[model samples]
Target: MRCPLARMTAETPLRYRFVGARGVRAWIAAPSVAQTQTPPRPLDPTEVETIAIIGRPSSQIAETLRRKRAAEVISDGVSAEQIGDLPAANLAEALQRVPGVAIEREVGEGQFVSVRGLGPLFQSVTLNGAPVAFNENIRNSTQSGRQFRFRALSVDLLAGARLAKSSTADMIDGGIGSNIDIETAGGLDGGPFLALRAGGEIEERTESLRPDLSIAGRIVSPDGSKGLVAGISQEDRRVRYDRFQIMRYGAFAVSGAPLTAPNDVRTTVEREDRRRRSAFLGADWRVSPNLKLDFDGLVSSFDNTIREDRLCPPSAPLRQIEGSV
Candidate 1:
């Protein structure tokens, strides 16, 4: 049997349908009996519009590595996004993530930091390259050393932090071990954005929750040459600490032989209510293709209300052991 070839005529009908897109409904289009027989024409170049898309993708790790590679000295850093994603509450806690850096805790919160096993006094910390003063309200005011307390500042207001392991001519003195600098974003650097964050901190001893809140925003000029950024944060924390102290180890004669024993023993319990507030403001101006100026300012306040109870030996009666046994 032979099959006959089919021919299309104006009388034939044609139906076409297209898949639906997001926010668009699918529909069927049927050609008119007269239009189906018309010849196809090429599209006109002048009538068509050309569209182009440009994008630059960035992340905290990439930005950090870029800065590290570009810096003149041996340095490590963390970007703002990385800081925010970390499970850290304060600047000291965040700095612990850096290699060869360690932190000292007080009342379960990081307060002092050391670099490469060097003490806190050997390291220097700056806010936007400006020196930060020691906290006046720190415990044992008379014994306050050169170590700067990290408890006074909050992590939310920073754009990034850098730790320099080597010395540089432009850096300020006093950082024989290392230098740390925390920076805030300027208007043009952050672009135009507004963010509000809220969270809670739980203290295991009291079984109570504390509140934390922060607001950050940035505005850029229409010309894109100037901008300003600001951030404010407030946090409340409850801490309970128990401390045992052995004042000194002394040699005691027991039946003829000398034995080492603790001279005095003491115990203390501390309950603290801490409230911290920090604010940051920064502006950026691009004067020329190679010249850019930045201004950054930061202020923070830390309030600690403590209730402590101590048990100690009596000074006059229990202290005197006149002759060696």
Candidate 2:
């Protein structure tokens, strides 16, 4: 049975109630019930369709999960994830769990990355699918500009990171072992949100303390047609390394084995004071459904001073020269 003017009441027989074409509420009852209420105008077919669609789903990891899953399905290898979802503070530390990856650090900072057991020389890195070229002529007898310096990159502005193992024609050249692409976040990618993080660390061996901070935010237009995002991160750190070296393999030869006691080892100590910071800005405009525009830029700076003291018997008698010998 139907009711002409059903109302929200203490005892409504219908499981659900809805307003009909008229002003009267529609409901189901055992027997017909009619209430005198003014008739309403009819709803247009377009209005009914518009009211049927609901809002979109929301989740922090939704977009990243989709991309990673899509890549897994479309490509032969690799995965991707948002940087904020990573457990480590730096890209190097985060990549250690990415399987077939290794990290090398200098003075307690990740200096380089190795993939598939190959050294950094075979590994290539890029920012937003473009190789970050380095000067090979400036190599100080040690570096040949084979890989990007991980220590110089800041994780604060990272939107997402991916490890591409399978080679593709569109991928930037240079990766023999593996290719890593790091994308920065901003504008529509970040959406309308604010993120703040602060932490500190103390190294007992170094007998020093350090502080870390990061701030990021994204603002979008009322209709979400335009947006801007910006962020900054800074950290101060001190590290110390002290150890003893055997000096030479001949020191362990036969009779020299007994002469190669720990006391005969050379002693060295080094201390480094480091400061790091990263800043980024981004803009996005959805001019139309099929056309859009995006602009992003980032800069990172690292400054450090190192002091070393060494007591190696033979080398102690001579002064060491700096720069290429």
Candidate 3:
């Protein structure tokens, strides 16, 4: 009919531990006696404490999630939580805390992270263990190497994100920098989770405002066997730079003697505005207790326009005039 209830202790998280039968059972407190099955006691202080402690139970589910993550990690890694709760303009800056992690910044904002001093081309970025496309939000699309642009990403919806300093056969290939795998929100990660983030920054010189916004969440079935998560992020930024250089052209000889002069000089000012949008989707199903299936997708688009003002002064090399003489 009943058995001694499991004791509540911090050493072992709170969970039902049936000693007797598993089909259907209940908890019954046993009182101390010389040798008796029943004692004359409604409830005692000790028994009362036990019942009260059960009311506030530690979540075994949370512990399960922690252990699962630990099992999935095989090498030295950096998780999003390791990034700490601090002010970061982009994911690249958030990753700076990881050992051997370096980031490249564009217009004072982090754009890419290099692992172990290796450049982005050496690193591979993945979403939920799947490769995300290579769409960098930068002025130069011609930039080389395989890399993900951190500037276009928002970190609000990740269940877990990690950069693996090493790799195994199970991991996807092509990351000389590091293999950075990001896990999206899943049914087990949370219940009815919703997150919204928005922020703005002002440029000192141009006095222009840059804005970013994102929303993400996950919804799960009642049994926690299936779930779906999706998110979208948008950002607008403006950048400026100035440069001056002397243009060199072929020069003529001066009176048959060798001579050369700068042919032209120019000063240029440039300004660029970029709008980037990124989105992600995730779905998972626990097919039968052991077999599980998951899907994740990521897409990004960037539109950048640049304006330039240039002034060039024309000059002729004196070598030509000397050769004529």
Question: Positional deviation of 24 in candidate 1, in angstroms?
Answer: 74
Segments of candidate 1 deviating more than 4 angstroms: 1-59, 135-144, 242-269, 310-325
**CA RMSD (A), model 1:** 16.1
Per candidate, the number of residue pairs that clash is: 2, 0, 1
* Span of 10 residues, lowest total lDDT, candidate 1: 2-11
The sequence of per-residue lDDT tens digits that candidate 2 reaches over residues 159-230 is: 656777766777877777777887777588645888898988888888776999999899999998899999
- Top lDDT model: 1
Q: List ranges where model 3 is wrong by over 4 Å.
A: 1-84, 134-144, 244-265, 316-325
Q: For model 1, how does the per-residue alpha-carbon lDDT over 253-287 read when each residue is reduced to its tens digit? A: 66556667776788999899999999988888999
> Against the true structure, what is each candidate's TM-score?
0.68, 0.66, 0.62
Q: Which ten residues in a row have the lowest lDDT in candidate 3?
A: 2-11
RMSD (Å) per prediction: 16.1, 18.6, 21.3
Error of 3 at 248 (Å): 6.1
Model 1 pairs in collision:
187-227, 187-228
